[model samples]
Target: MTKKIVVLGVSGSGKSLIGKNIADKLDYPFFDGDDFHCQANVDKMRQGTPLTDEDRKDWLATLNTILTDNPTAVIACSGLKPEYRAMLRKGLDDITMIYLKGTIDTIWQRHQKRDGHYFNGREMLESQFATLVEPEKDEALVIDISQDASAVLNEALSLLSKK
Candidate 1:
């Protein structure tokens, strides 16, 4: 069955690249959770502030609603904490989470190379890691981001096919 797929990770982990590719491959809509963020949230990130759970409540709920409304879709989001993931999954099922895993050093380097993104800074990334609760074996297909983007996408496609 086709399912709602979430490409999840910290900022600069290539979630957008993989998520969009998978969405195209599956002929599903692509939703960047970043795009769903309110201007206030965007401004906070732009200012190098890490958002608290309360800050994410509406954003997470809105993403969940989008998933519910479009059951077959792929979304890129930083599902950082267990509660956040739970929020995304609320009122939905058959959601496949693909976590792009990497160390802060790797992600920090990538973040530096990115242009015009609001989510910024090593400090912010550190806060994200601090809040993160890695998905268990059953909850996600974890793809290490050390490999080339093509390799990561191929692996994700292969894993999704099996699912």
Candidate 2:
């Protein structure tokens, strides 16, 4: 059966690229969670400001609604915090979080090379790391970001197909 999949990670972990590819392969709607951010949040990130949990609450709520409503779509989201992941899980079952795990250095390197992205590499790196609570009790498919995107997607798709 089709299932809701949240591709979770810090910035520059290639969640969007991989998630979109997986969604296309699976014939599911792909939603970039970044698109759900409000203008204020976008402005803050563009200005190198880190978002407080308060700043993200409403956005997360909206994501929850979208995911719940869609039932089985793919979402690329930085579900960095445990509580945030829990919030996403609320009122939803058959949801799987695929964590694209990587070191801060790797993430920063990727972010720095990103020419037109909103997030400031130096500033948000720390915040993203700080907010991160690694997937609980292996409740996710933790793929290394250093791997090839095709390989990573293959692994994820293999696992998801099993479920």
The whole-model C-alpha lDDT of candidate 1 against the native structure comes to 0.92
TM-scores of the candidates in the order shown: 0.97, 0.95
- Summarize candidate 2's per-residue lDDT along 30-122 as a digit string, tens digits: 999999999999999998899999998999998899899995799999989888998988998788889999998888878877888888757
Name model 1 segments beyond 4 Å from true. none
- C-alpha lDDT (0 to 100) for residue 34 of candidate 1: 99
Model 2 — TM-score against the truth? 0.95
- RMSD (Cα, Å) for all candidates, in order, is 0.9, 1.2
Q: For model 1, what is the error of residue 149's alpha carbon versus the real structure, in angstroms, after optimal superposition?
A: 0.6
- lDDT (CA) for every model shown? 0.92, 0.88
In model 2, which runs have C-alpha deviations exceeding 4 angstroms? none
